[model samples]
Target: MTDDSAALWVNGSVARLQGMPDDERLLDTLRWRLGLKGTKEGCRTGDCGACTVLVDGKSTLSCLTLTREVEGGSVTTIDGASDDPELKRVSAAFTAAEALQCGYCTPGFVVALAGLLKERGRSAPVEELMDGLQGNLCRCTGYAAIARAVALAREDAP
Candidate 1:
């Protein structure tokens, strides 16, 4: 690999990038370059968490993150959720709680919740979990089901 090239672990696999510009957003890299389309682009300004992903086990908004900034870091997206215990647990909770509506924001909510649970542990209170997810928004379901999913995710965190 050339010195200018960069590498990062995506979904537990090494992804080497070549000739990528320094300004390339991580969201674009994940969706277009790597074809991991699970991370959506809701707002490019980072106000929305639609592009949320886990970087080294912490929640990150890919739309606002530059690819070069995450070079050599481990990134986990909804595509990788099934392989991660925390992510899978939260995903299951969302499903069990019927939190999904239009579903565009479901992946962000799931990944963000998993990251928060990982950071704060399963013992973190429901209010704290909800606060951590403040950046994620959904126009459907009135957030009632989502709130239930958050509580359920906390209840079942491993």
Candidate 2:
């Protein structure tokens, strides 16, 4: 009965998300079909980063990713980011600096920071860092503290 379903590979496990015709709503599947709840559901329109996850080693909006599109790709969540050194640094810095107030947008910022640190390296200027983090929005902190957290994280990056 389950043989005619597409398999989604996530967090080193393969699960078939049934009822999805074209993998279009995989994010909801991850929350509903699977038990991975770390990835939150925010703006379903992709405007918010609450549903952010790493697809193929890059930060992507889970709300926008189709389950079929990521058939063979590796999906990494906040739970998976703990092992990444750069992400660890960012997490620590965020905590130390109190970068998050409401914390709804923190995960997305961390994920974005990871991608930026990976692509731009550790020496990115503050301005560039600000630009890189523009996509992830935080309404509670006014962004100054978050920016400082990223700066400290970059310094702590090896």
Candidate 1: tens digits of C-alpha lDDT, residues 11-86: 9999998888888999999999999999999978888799999999999999989899999999999999879999
lDDT values of the candidates?
Answer: 0.91, 0.76
TM-score of each: 0.95, 0.85
RMSD of each: 1.9, 2.6
| Residue-by-residue lDDT tens digits, candidate 2, 14-131 | 6766656664666776777787777778888888777877777688888988777787677777766676676678788889888888787888888788778777888887788789
**Model 1 pairs whose backbones collide:** none
Question: Worst lDDT window (10 residues) for model 2?
Answer: 1-10
